[model samples]
Target: MHSFTVQQINEVLQGELVGNTTHSITGVEEIRNAKKTDLTFIGNRKYAKFWADSNASVAIINDTIDLEPGENRAFVKVKNADLAMAKLLEAFQPETPVFETEIHPTAVIHETATIGKGVQIGAHCYVGKNVTLGDGVILYHNVSVFDDSTIGPQTVAWSGTVIRERSQIGAQCIFHNNVSIGADGFGYRPADDGRGLVKIPHIGNVVIGNGVEIGANSCVDRAKFNSTIIGDGCKIDNLVQIAHNCIMGRSCIMAGHSGLAGSVTLGDGVVIGGSASIKDHTTIESGATVGAGSGVMNNVKAGQTVLGYPAADSRDMLKQWVALRRLVK
Candidate 1:
């Protein structure tokens, strides 16, 4: 385990330290579970209440929280305890796996492919014809990049990730294991002759912007005509699905298991809670937030917060809920 003195931790967080500056902290843990040598954080009132009974020797606390350091313990007070803890965790992060070679011998690279300097291709990885991988790109074992795709500099794709033909990915992006990009969209219609359904061809591709991070098993389908776009700094959680022609603006966040139907539009900074589903062609403007498990069937105004199935404004939903409870009584 990595160890740091209370003084060192305070320096890393740029927080004001109180008491036991020389105390050693070996690891971080939740306030209720921390040991005497562990470091913890109190970010809100719920967590702050547990501090007095916690056994931790050091704690990162919000400046707004009223608490005094007890004997033999130390407190590092910062404007945002959660953010301070994240910084400290980065300092303590373990080393990541390193590739044994720049390009593994078992990897297959097409003669027409362009691989820039410092690129690393792991075992069983495949780079198809006319593919362009920028400098410092890393494709972990079993990753596959199909024909005509362009992945920008410093992008890292983990095992089992597939970037299909004509897909364009931007710089500093991270694709977790099993992520599927540029898959054919779900589009089908009944056959004219009264037979089985006919599949609609998805001829376009997926375009992802810089600094995006897609969690494991998430899928972003290719567009029916032009492109399915994900803007810069967007973070998509595990198991999420983004359908064809969806346009997501910068810094949008989708929690685990959330999804957007075909042609859905999300403006910058939109937040979709876990298990939320947006209907086809629906628009969610910038800064709008959809509550967990919501089934949005219409457009959501910018900065509005919606809740419930066929989601309505949060305030209206709450009032309806209250009325229903009274009716039951």
Candidate 2:
């Protein structure tokens, strides 16, 4: 339990204090849950109702507000109280987590692998031959990087994440728990004489651009020849399936459970809603948005908003709904 006097907080935030400046704040809290020894901030004027006879020792407030400071609670005035609070919180917050710098006893790192500075290889991790890990990379428990894999600087792979051989992930990428990259792509043919199926080999790997964030339990499969590319600044949500050879452009956003089939191409600033499915080889242009539960089979023009199965135009979908409602009347 770290304690900071009101004077100490003002030094950190360079804010003005008034009304019983001698009071000290023990901890920070939300407006509704604040205790007598705590400091809570109020931003919106509508939330001022919660401040009546509040138990907090101090209120960090914006300078624009016209209010009187009471004896029970002092006021720390600032241009932006929220941003000021962030500074204080960061200063008082715990240090960046330490996974031991020394390789764990259970970790198996191939001798040929190249690991850069400040790397932490956690329990039971397996690094294959020729794998290259950049500076400040942290691989949590049971994560595996197969042969020839390369992870860029400042990346963190959470527990149970797996990168198949030859995969390449860019800088500052975060792979949440159980993410599987460069796993076998689905390419199969019916066996001879109507026998069991024969699965073709997935020969390619994945290339993730810088600043891309992939969520938990997502699977991005390997392509046949070329790399399956995730463009820079792409944000993907949980349980999404990115099939082989799909290329996402910069700043594309895909919501939870969305699936893109093989060879799909998405332009910059495209937004895909939750549970949407884009068909194979489809091309979606820049700044286009596909609504939730949409099934996109054809190309979506730039700056267009589409919705529904087979993805009709947004205006068309709305008109159809309106006509359906008029039928009942």
Candidate 3:
């Protein structure tokens, strides 16, 4: 186990030290699960009571709060204990697996494709005509980059991921396993002859900004005319679906199983919880938060917290629920 002295941790956190700096902390854990060699943190006031009884040898605490006077545990008090804990966790994180520069023998690269410096193309991967893979990009096993696609420097596409035609992926972006970027939009028109629906040609592509991380099995559909845009620092959880022409602003977060229908627009810092669904053409303003299992049928104003099916303001939804319960009585 990797260990660091309390003083060393204090230096990195820039926190006020209140106890034994010489003590060694080997790992980090929650207050309820900490061991004597573990470091824990109290970021919220509710967790303060656990400080006195926690088994951790070191605790990172918020500067605004105070622990009990007689507690034996050591402490590092910082402006934001949660942020400090994240830094400490990152410091202790293991490095990612490295690959050799040699391209795998089974990989197929079209002669027209542009391969950049230090790129690693794994077994069974295919780089199609005019595909441009920037320097230091890694395409793991079974990945595919279709014709005219451009993946920026240091981007990574895990196994079974596909970057379809004309997709533009930015630097340091991460496409998790089985992710499909630039897939055909689910748009269709009623056939004139009363036959099956005619598929609308998705001629446009997807433009993903830098630092975007799309989770496993997620799908971002290509646009009908223009691009489906995912802005910088957006984090999309597993199984999420972003339909064609959707434009998401920077730092937006969409949790697992959440979905946005066609032409949806999300302003910066909007958060969509698990299994939430936004109707087509809806606009979610900046900093709005849609709660889990919500069905957003209308535009949500900035800074609102919405919840429930055919979602309403969180506070209003609670009142409605209370009224329904009273009626059942």
Candidate 4:
């Protein structure tokens, strides 16, 4: 366990500290569950209301909130308490798994594959012919990099990740367990004789930019013609799906269970809420926010917020809801 004095934690957060600075914090916990030796945070009024009853030794609080540190408890006031807590948690993070050797005996590497410096290939991992793994790449156990694929420097693929042929992933990207990149897109057409469906071949690949992090079990499908591109700094949540030929601009955020159909386009900084689905060929401009559970069938203008089953302007949807409630009354 890691331990730090109230004063030391305050310095790390660079926040204003009030009350006792000598108390020791052994770990972090939720506001309601915190012990006397634990540290916690109050990011909003909901949590701030419980401060007086919390037994935590130190609490990081948002500067916008007006609260006092009671008795021996200390308060580290910052502009954003959540972000401040993130820094401390990173500092206290446990060590990650280290490879026993750079290349494990059970791993398979093709003679034509290019392995860069500081790469670690774990047991049962496979690097196919013509695959290029850049410097500092780490492939955990059971990971597979198929032919002609290229992974950039410092990229990490955890256990069970599969990078299919011709996929290109950029630097500092992370693929969590069971992530599927360059998977065949879901496409089929009715046969000429109407006997059965004909599968449409996904002949292209997936191109992901730098600093992208895909959560566990997420998938990015290969394109039908050109690459399905994910711009730099996008953060994808677990169980999300990006379908064939989808193009995402920089820093887009997709919540858990959200999905985009084939050829959907998102501009920079678009935020997709949980379980939201975008129809195929739809375009969402930059800074647009799609509310949770929304089914977007039309284009969303830049910076607009949409809501409802078939998403509409947030204000319009709210007005319609109000009218319905009045009718019920």
> What is the Å distance of residue 197 in model 2 from its true position?
2.5
Expressed as tens digits, the lDDT of each residue in 1-329 for candidate 3 is: 68898888989988898867445788889999999889999889999888777788888999899674244458888999988988999888987666654598999999999999989999999999999999999999999999999999999999999999999999999999999999999988999998999988999999999999999999999999889999999999999999999999999999999999999999999999999999999999999999999999999999999999999999999999999999999
Give one digit per residue, the lDDT tens place, for model 1 in 83-196: 889889998899778888999999999999999999999999999999999999999999999999999999999999999999999999999999999999999999999799
Worst 10 residues of 3 by lDDT: 66-75
User: Which candidate, 3 or 4, would have the higher lDDT against the true structure?
Assistant: 4
Each candidate structure's count of clashing pairs? 0, 0, 0, 0
Ranking by lDDT: 4, 1, 3, 2
In model 2, the clashing pairs are none
RMSD of 4: 1.0
| lDDT tens digits, residue span 1-329, model 4 | 78899989988999998888456789899999999999999999877889888889899999899888988888999999989999999878888998889999999999999999999999999999999999999999999999999999999999999999999999999999999999999999999999999999999999999999999999999999899999999999999999999999999999999999999999999999999999999999999999999999999999999999999999999999999999999
Task: Assess candidate 2 and give its TM-score to the true structure.
Answer: 0.79
Query: Distance from true position, residue 133, model 3, in Å?
Result: 1.7
TM-score of each: 0.98, 0.79, 0.93, 0.98
TM-score: the better of candidates 2 and 4 = 4
The better-scoring model by lDDT among 2 and 4 is 4
Which consecutive 10 residues in model 4 have the weakest lDDT in total? 17-26
Error of 4 at 143 (Å): 0.6
lDDT (Cα, tens digit) per residue for candidate 2, span 88-203: 78866766556765578899999999999988889999999999999988898899999999999999999999999999999999999999999999988999978989988889
Off by over 4 Å in 3: 68-72
